[model samples]
Structure formats: C-alpha cells, structure tokens
Target: MPDTEGHPEVNEIELVDVFAALADPLRLKVVRDLLAEPDGVERHCTSFGLPVSKSTRSHHFKVLREAGLIRQVDRGNSRMATLRRADLETRFPGLLSSLS
Candidate 1:
C-alpha cells in the first residue's frame, strides 16, 4: 500500500512514466475527472464509477500515483485522490490543458 508521501516528488517525475500511466484509457479518465473538479477537491477512488473490479481500479490509481499525476491518501475506509495539478503544471506546462 502506498501513502501520499510515497509518491515521487514533482522534480523526480519523468515524462515517460506519466505517458505510460496515461496510456490506459481508465487511468487517463481518472486524471481527466480529477482535473475537471474544482481545485483542492479530493475524490474517493470508488467514486469514479469505473466498469472494473475494485482491484483493477486500485491498480489504475496506483499507476497514476506512482507517476506523480495524483496524490492519494487514506480517508477513513476510502482512499481519496486529488490531481497533482500544481505539481504537474510546474513540471510540464500546458500538459494538462492539452489533455482536456
């Protein structure tokens, strides 16, 4: 299980890793949904309504977190996720806009 602190630092984020993480449609949708939310809003992992198993959804979140695209933390029994918007913008300008 990975914690919020376990994610790669913004400076340590690599383009290839981010690209690979977003290569999956599910993973890309997760990021896009987060981006659509207002700033500072953290959504629970299960709220995505994805057509996949719990474990598969967890895997997608893991990939995004490891790629420095999202920050996730345990909130009660649910895992909350927020798009690392500022961090991503800092590391790769115009990237998020292009995705939207």
Candidate 2:
C-alpha cells in the first residue's frame, strides 16, 4: 500500500489511516493554525500548542505526514508542516469541508 513505483493505485489510500491521523485534537489544531498562518509563514512542529513532550509531538506530526493529512519539509534548521489541501480534497471529497 506504500506509494511505490509498482503501486499504480497510489490514489487508492485507506480511510482508516487518514481518519486516524486527524483523530487527535492537537493535530486538528495544528491544521487549523497552518491554514491561518500568513502566506509564507511555514509553521514548525514545535509551534503547535502541544502540551506533550517533543518526542510525542514529533510522533503526531509523523502520523499526519505518513497518512498524507499534512506535508512536512525540512528548512535550514527546522521542520515545517503544511496541510496537503488540494490532494486531500481530490482523494476524499468534502473531507476538509466538514472539518472546517
């Protein structure tokens, strides 16, 4: 099911993984904040109001990224996370619409 070359049906992703990634309140908040950040303000994982330890926060972000709920990129010294808005909309229509 990994998005490998052989997997021509990469778009046939499961809803369980996607739903699981968005299940957390903190993760939801992260997405909400990312949408609000100004055009160029790439929010780091730590910028989220996650009360857990850094390790836990990292875990949450990883889950979201792996499930395609968010995108993470490494900038100079920090990792930035942004919502995969269009992709998610195409894959699961009305998914983000209900959340917002």
Question: Which candidate has the highest lDDT of all?
Answer: 1
**TM-scores of the candidates in the order shown:** 0.93, 0.80
Which numbered prediction scores highest in TM-score against the true structure? Answer: 1
| Per-residue lDDT over 1-100 for candidate 2, one digit per residue giving the tens place of the 0 to 100 score | 5453211132855578878877888888877777676534567888887999989998888877777777777889998877777777778888876786
Model 1 lDDT at residue 38: 96
Model 2, 85: alpha-carbon shift in Å? 0.2
TM-score of 2: 0.80
Tens digits of per-residue lDDT, candidate 1, 1-100, equal 3345669988888999999999999999988998899987999998889999988888888889999999998888878999999999999999999999
